[model samples]
Target: MQKAPERLIDENGFRLDGRRPEEFRPIKLQVGILDNPDGSAFIEQGKNKIIVGVYGPREIHPKHMVLPDRAVIRCRYRMAPFSTEERKNPAPSRREIEISKVIREALEPAVMPEYYPRTVIDIFVEALQCDGGTRCAGIVAASLALADAGISMRELVSACSVGKVEGQIVADLFDLEDKYGEADMPVAIMPNLNKVTLIQMDGKLSRDEFERAFEMALDGCRKIRNLQAEALKRRCEVLTGTEMPEKGSLEAH
Candidate 1:
């Protein structure tokens, strides 16, 4: 088990990386990053680096699992063997299995699977590096990939994690904070729908604390949602040769 931070927060109210309590680590998103996948994206948030690809709306194998009225959503969340301080086993761990199911469920609400009945949409997310919050980061990238792949959807799903560390509620818990924090909660929301798809907690917290952390997580997700939109916009521009607006303007005048 990982041990707690000797000091989760300094008297100056900064985390070990000199971040403020409510601050999220920097995030970088790029869409259509892979050529083979129908849609793909890459993200680097804080110390976590992840890549996600969306494939299909293709036929489902083992045909019996196919839904007559909607498409099947399959998600695989994996961590590279060298992603952590210690080499993770190449085989999936129990936590990874649970997280895979969590991610699939979290993204289901945003997809209009009914349009692609008898098909399947497969999402693959792999972590190249991690410090914490990899799951939420994966959600952001996966949503972008889905859009890049042209999957019909109601809205993108965004996610973030918040927790109480050192008796202070902080947004975007990292490795040390999570290992020692009193509470670590990860929340995913459909950005435009304003509905939560997933909210899981690993530690105890008072109702008041939970409410505050929940709001913080939502706020973080909103910020991430904007970034995701921008990524998709940029990807579109690149594909349509609209990067130089003077000749091929996407903006209406």
Candidate 2:
């Protein structure tokens, strides 16, 4: 096999993609992109692309798993066979199962499950492309899909990844950086509440570095939240023939 590439961060502090340590990849979001699901959204962050659909507040299946006082939330995250360089298997992998659980937990705090007793909310996310940070992108898209469905939510969820590359903390690692970087951390937050709902870390970091990475990730999340809001506003405007609302102002509590 050929040798791997050189260090991710250059001596001038620019990444392989020419981004600074704290810069995030460009993100685009679109809401209500599908007609069948109660809500649907698509997102492109860097080279990662994902679509999510939200359904329910409908009856729970099996009847045994129903919550007496709250709606049961289920999540499924899948990667398409062509999502990566090597065609992934069609079946869900163990990693997908774990991510599904984590994503469900992240949205649980924002959704008003108590309002829909004996019901269930199902969130499905599909990865159409992969470039690292797919989970973060999925969370952001899923949250928008939920909102588009008009589900009762305390706030929209936004997420991004941060990592230590060449001893420098960087925001939004791409596939190459993620594979070679020293550490990776992904975070999800409720933008309106200013509360973190999901945080996962890998590799290692000192306290100071961890804090720096967290702040950088949070900043990225806030920016993603703005994009999410813009997507929602655009859809709303299209339907109502109104101007776009101020960012985050349309957030429902």
Candidate 3:
């Protein structure tokens, strides 16, 4: 059996990235970042960088996959040729297909498919850089891209990963930590209803450890939900040329 490397430590309780157990890595998001797509967004979380593009509620091609009662959500997830330390071949691997399916399933519940029967909503996410948790990051980016395209959704989706390291539960595991940590659990959440749309786990954990990790993931999701809301509000402000009113201004009116 391979032994794990020496655990990361900080005398003040910070992790390798100098973040507290529950704090997330820095995240940057931009909508409409691609020129040719109906909707697109870029998201960077720590060292992970992903771009998501959304096209349609357009007519379904091939004519046979369209359903009578609902629109289909299609997703393709890919890793760029230079996306990792070791170059990945320029082909979609089985892991990418699996992740794409998971992302599509995660977003399907948020969309109202009945509104666009016989059509298709397609999303493509490209991982330009990876350091862990690309699937969760891609899902979040896809949700934002879909919303930016003005598609209706029951709620916005937010995702993050949590893990245990050195007996501490940490949020947003980075590459090294994820590779060496005791466990990793990624979750996709619908914040309005406090429901989970996707959950995946790897590594070993006891029952209590699983519960603790889950709680941490939930908390991370809520924090990310707030950030997502703020990003959308900022985007709307930019598009409409209207500033967000002061907190008490509406009450004053």
Candidate 4:
């Protein structure tokens, strides 16, 4: 077997991007962007960019898939042909199918499916760009889109990736780190309930290392949750033509 690659962390404990072990890349979110979709959102986490649109809670085609006691959740995750370094085929591959299934499961727990029985809720995620951790980023965007569309949810979902590089756990792995890291784990959480919705790990890690990485992922999820809420509030204000109250104003108080 080939020897392990060089360490991503420098002597000073700074990673290639100059981030510390616990630091996450800046994340930005925009909600209610698409005109036709019931809910839509866009997100950028580091170099990965994703757009999510939610439709239905309206009707289900194929008639047979409809549920009597709850709504069915369907998801499609696709990476654009130009999303990565190499040109990719436009057709959905096995990887895309698996991702779609996982993403649907990740968001299902937060949705109040029983409220819209006999209907279907569809989530479509498009990856406009990819560096690393695109699946986790998609989860964040899709959750926001559901909220923007006025879908009832038990809680907002947030997701982030954590990786161990050179014996240190880092939050939000970038391209280089993700490619060469010792271990990679992506996690999604329902922040209000402090419950994990989805988690997957690749590469070997000690039990202790796994616990540390998990905790780090939770912290990252909390931060992303704040950003998600802020985006939704701003979108609501924009749609209602209402200005945000001043920090010390009575409305704010």
Among the numbered candidates, top TM-score falls to 1
Q: Model-by-model lDDT, in order?
A: 0.89, 0.89, 0.85, 0.89
> Model 1, residue 12: displacement in angstroms?
0.8
User: What tens-digit string does per-residue lDDT give for candidate 3 at 1-253?
Assistant: 3355565657788888888888788887777777778888888888899999999889999899989999889999999989887888988799898999989988999988898889999999999999989999898889999998878899988999998887788888987788888888989999889999999999888899889889888888887777777667767886897956652111100
In model 4, the runs with Cα more than 4 Å from the true position are 1-6, 245-253
TM-score order, best first, reads 1, 2, 4, 3
Candidate 1 per-residue lDDT, tens place, 1-253, comes to: 5555689889999888898999888888889989999999999888899999999889899999999999999999999999998899999999999999999999999999999999999999999998888999899899999999999999999999999998989998888888887889999999778999999998988999889999999988988888888778888889998875543322110
The alpha-carbon RMSD values of the candidates against the true structure, listed in the order shown, are 4.0, 3.7, 4.7, 4.3
TM-score list, all predictions: 0.94, 0.93, 0.91, 0.93
The residue-level lDDT of candidate 3 at 15 comes to 85
Clashes of 2: 0
Deviation in angstroms for 228 in model 1?
A: 0.7
lDDT of 4: 0.89
Kindly list the per-residue Cα lDDT of model 4 for residues 107-179, writing each as its tens digit.
Answer: 9999999999999999999999988899999999999999988899999999999989888888898777888
* Ten contiguous residues with the weakest lDDT in model 3: 244-253
Residue 194 in candidate 2, Cα distance off native in Å? 1.9
Shift in Å, residue 39, candidate 3: 1.6
Residue by residue across 1-253, what tens digits does model 2's lDDT show? 2245698888888999888898887787888999999999998877888999999878887999999999999999999999998889998899999999999999999999999999999999999999999999999999999999899999999999999988999998998888888999989999778899999999889999999899888888887787787788888987787854554432211
lDDT of 2 at 95: 95
The alpha-carbon deviation from the true structure for residue 47 of candidate 4, after best TM-score superposition, in angstroms, is: 1.0
